[model samples]
Target: MTVIDNTHQRLLPAPAADVGRLLDRIGRPGDPLWPSPTWQPMRLDRPLSVGATGGHGPVRYHVSDYRPGRLVEFTFDPRIGLTGTHTFEVIDHGDDACVLRHRLVATPSAHMRPLWPALIGPCHDTVLEHLLDNAEHAVTGTVTDPVRYPWQARLDVRLFSVQVNATSVPQNALLLEAALPPAAGPRSDLADAYAARVPPGVTTDPQAWADAIFGNPPPAVTALFRLRNALVTPFGIERGDRSAFDTISRTDRELLLGTDAGHLDFRASILVEPDDDGVTVTLSTHAVAHHRTGRLYLALVRLFHPPVVRAMLRRAAAAAVRPRPVTPPGLPTTTPLR
Candidate 1:
C-alpha cells in the first residue's frame, strides 16, 4: 500500500477572485485552467457544483465540495480506490495578486501501486504543472516556465491520451474536388477515405489543421519512406516523387497532396471542417495503378494503410496540442479550450 500527497501551486499577478473564477470553469466549455487537447478536458456529468460527477481522461470522481471563487474538491470513486481527495484552491496574496493550487492525496490500490509511480505519477505531476501554467497565463497572460514532460512522461501521455478513432470520410470532406478522385475517372483502383475528428484542444482552422497533419512526419512514416526508396532504386523507379508528404495545393481550409510515382499515381486529401464543437480532419487516399507492380504495391500496402493513416492523423492531433510555455507571435501555442 502506498499513500501520496501531491501538490502544485502558482502565484499569479491577478486578484484571488480572478484566479478562483477559473476554478468555477474547470470542466466548463471555456476552461482556462485545465491544460487540454494535450490532455483531456475535465468533464462532469453536470455543472461544477457539489455532487457533479466526472473526471478527466480515465480518472473518475465526483465533486464532494465546492466553494465558488475559492475552492473545489473532488472525491475519487471508491470503485477506483481513493484515500483523500483532489482539490483546487485559491489563496489571496494582495489586491492584485493571488495563488492557485491543485493537490491530490491518495492511497494507491494494489493494482495501481506499481503502475502509479511508473506511469500515472509522472503524468499526473506534469498535468498539474500544466494546469497551473494555464492558470498563471489566464490570469497573468504569460507563462515564463511552462511544464515540459520528460520523454517517458511524454510517451506515457501520448499512449494514454484521448483516443480518436478513424471513420469513413464524411461526404463533405470528399466534396473537395481538388482533393480526391482520378483526374480522368470518377474513382481509381485504390480510392479510400479515412477520417478522424480534430481534437477539441486544437485549432479549428483548416490551414492550422493541415499543418498539424502534414508538418511532422512520424518515425514510422520516415522509416517507410527510406524503405520505399531502397525498394524502388533497385528497379530504376523514381521513389521519392512524393517526398513522403507532398503538397499539390493549400488553402485556408483544405490541402491537396500526393504523387505520380513511377508505377502509381496517388493523391491524398486532408480536409478540415469546423462545426459547433471543433473540427474534423479527413484524410483520403486515391491511387491509380499503372502496371502490375503498382497493383501489387497497393495490394500489399492496403492491409496496413488504414491503421497507418489513422496513426498519422492521431499523432498530428496530439502534436498540435502538447503543452509548452506560451510565447506568442499569434495565438498562444495551445488552442483555447472550447
Candidate 2:
C-alpha cells in the first residue's frame, strides 16, 4: 500500500488574480497552461464546473472541486488503480506575484506501484514542469527556464506519445491518388497513409516538415535508407536519395515528392490539415513496381514501412516544436539531431 504525494509549484510574475484568470482558461482551445499536443491537453466536457468529466491521455478523471480562479481539483477514476485527487492552486502573495502549484495525492493500486517510479513518474514530472513553463510563458510572454527532458524521459515520451494510425488517404493528399492514376482502380501496387498529431505552434507546412524529416532523419531510418540505396549500385540504378526527392506538386496544405528508377517508381504526400484541437499531419505513399524484382523488393519492405514512417513523422514534429532535440543516451553523434 504505497502512497504518493507529489507537488510542483512555480512562482509566477503576475498577481494571484491575474494568474487565476489564466488558470480559468485551462482546458479551452489554445489552452495556455496544459502544454498540449506535445502532452495530452486537459479537457473537460464543458467549462470548469464541479462534475465536468474528462481526462488527458489515458488517465481518466472528473472535476471534483473548483473555485472560480483560486483552485481546481480533479479526482482520478479509481478503476485505473489510482485513488485520490490532483489539483492546480493559485496562491496569493500579497503583491504582484503568486505561486502556481500542482499537487497529486494518490495511492496506486498494487500492480501499478512497480510501474510508477520507472515509466509513469518520469513522464509525470516532465509534463508538470512543462505545464508550469506554459503558465509562465502565458503570464510573461516567454519561459525563462524551460524544463530540459532527460534522454530516458525523452524515450518514455516517444513511447507513450499520441499514436500514429492507419487512416484513409485524405482527399487533400492530392498527389496520393494522382501519382499513379493508371493503377488507381485495381492495379495499384501500393498505397498507404498514416496520420500523427501536431501541436499548436509546430510547422504545419510540408516544406518545413520535409526539412526536419529528411534533413535530420532518425538514426535507424537513415541507416535503413543507406542499405536500400547501396542495394541499387550493382544494378546501375540511381539510388533513392531522400534529400534529392523532387517536389512533384504542391498545394497550400500538401506537398508531394517522388523519384523514378529502372525498376521502381515512387511518390509520397505530406498533408498538414487543421483539426479541432491542433493539426493532423498525414503521410501518404504511392508506388508502382516496374519489374518482378521491384515487386519483390516492395513486398519485403512493406513489412517494415509503417513503423519507419511513424518515427520519421514524429521526429519531424518534435524538431518543429521542441526547444532542443533529445537523443537517447547511447545514440551516436553522427546520427541526425533527433
TM-score of each: 0.80, 0.84
What does candidate 2's lDDT look like per residue over 47-127, in tens digits? 889999988768999999999889999999998879999999999866988889999999999878988887788788888
Question: Backbone clashes per model, in order?
Answer: 0, 0
Task: Name the lDDT value of residue 195 in candidate 1.
Answer: 59
Worst 10 residues of 1 by lDDT: 329-338
Give me the displacement of residue 216 in model 1, in angstroms: 3.2
| Candidate that scores best on TM-score | 2
Writing each residue's lDDT as its tens digit, candidate 1 over 1-338 gives 56888888777778887887788998887787777667766888888899999987668999999999999999998667565699998988778877787889988777788877787788888888878777767765766566778776678656655356656645655334654444635536676776555335677566565566666658887687678778876655666733545667776666777767777887777777755334567777777888887777778778878777777788787676666666443434333211
User: How does each model score on lDDT?
Assistant: 0.72, 0.76
Task: For model 2, give the RMSD to the true fold.
Answer: 6.3
Error of 1 at 309 (Å): 3.0
Model 1: residues with Cα > 4 Å off, grouped in runs: 162-166, 176-187, 193-199, 212-215, 226-239, 242-254, 259-263, 273-280, 291-293, 303-311, 327-338
Instruction: List runs of model 2 lying over 4 Å from the truth.
Output: 182-185, 198-201, 291-307, 317-338
RMSD of 1: 5.2
How much does each candidate deviate from the true structure in C-alpha RMSD? 5.2, 6.3
